[model samples]
Target: MLYQSFSGDAEVGTSIFTMNGGSLTAAIGPLFYITNTDSIIELKDADLTAMSGTLLTASADRWGNNGSNGGVVTLKAENETLDGSITCDSISSVTVMLQNSTVLEGSMNAENTAGSMA
Candidate 1:
């Protein structure tokens, strides 16, 4: 998939890279990345779990048919679930730009926190 940034800010940067895509049955680990500015990203469900046996996976997709809107994809329920724990490590800081449809009504654990929207 393609991950595009909607924000036009100068200090903003977005990335859509597939770290791993093989088999969820194999051993898995935490997925980590870095952000320097404010932005919104989305991941779609495109048979990404087919080869990996992942009932729940992270894939970027177009938001509301608006590629520039900058929204996030929701992974509520699916075929496969996350295999293990999630760890986030950051050196400086990060910002979370949440849109109206993007909801995180659950618990989250992280390190080196920064910005958020409610």
Candidate 2:
């Protein structure tokens, strides 16, 4: 993937990664390093009955596409907890919905956007 980044430096791509449970051992580097526009990332809290220690963690930064055009991120957490970070460049969009008294740790950084967790 590193080689592709140096090809043109004009096009920004999108990749999706999802996890349902358990651990991901021996992982190197950031799982999601988004720096593109028109990307979609959805992190919803599913399976609330089990109630494990920690469910998910994420980090993304989409700021390379068109200088300030980031992708879209939809996070829906219901009856669970989520941690990590999400960052968007200028003119990006993100919708975060926490239901059933859910908890979201870590941070979400979005420029020129408004959101509330209640």
Candidate 3:
């Protein structure tokens, strides 16, 4: 699907946000805040351009009751640009496809023990 303007936190709880051959443009608040353990956010063959807020994963305290499992953000898209940051703080993981080209204008912090961006 194509999203013109996306605002607020999209708390994905054990669910998937699949951008299939489309684009999602963030115009206001943070695009996503993964709060559920083992939740996935998949961007497949798509594009995401952030005009405003960041795309952030949750912390241990925010990860529901089962914070040990952590969450994953899979970027399978061809291209992506973040005007804001993409943060995964010690309780989340992000996998970016080798073929994808991603640009971050702000800052990205993947500093948790379990958090990784690769």
Best by TM-score: 3
Arranged by TM-score, best first: 3, 2, 1
- For candidate 2, what is the lDDT? 0.41
- The positional error of residue 71 in candidate 1, measured at the CA in angstroms, is 21
Question: Model-by-model lDDT, in order?
Answer: 0.29, 0.41, 0.53
List the candidates' TM-scores in order: 0.26, 0.44, 0.55
Model 3 lowest lDDT segment of ten:
1-10
Q: Write the per-residue lDDT of candidate 2 for residues 1-118, one digit (tens) a residue.
A: 1111323755545544444544342244433333333343443444322123222222223334343433444555556565444444444455567777777665665232322211
**Highest lDDT model number:** 3
Q: Residue by residue across 1-118, what tens digits does model 3's lDDT show?
A: 1111113355434455666667677676566655434445656455666555575544444323554645566644345554566666575676654346655556566333446776
- Model 3 residue pairs with clashes: 90-112
lDDT of 1 at 60: 25
Candidate 3, lDDT over the whole model: 0.53
How many clashing residue pairs appear in each of the predictions shown? 9, 0, 1
Model 3 residue 113 distance off true place after TM-score fit, in angstroms: 7.9
**Pairing residues by index, what is the TM-score of model 2?**
0.44
* lDDT ranking, best first: 3, 2, 1
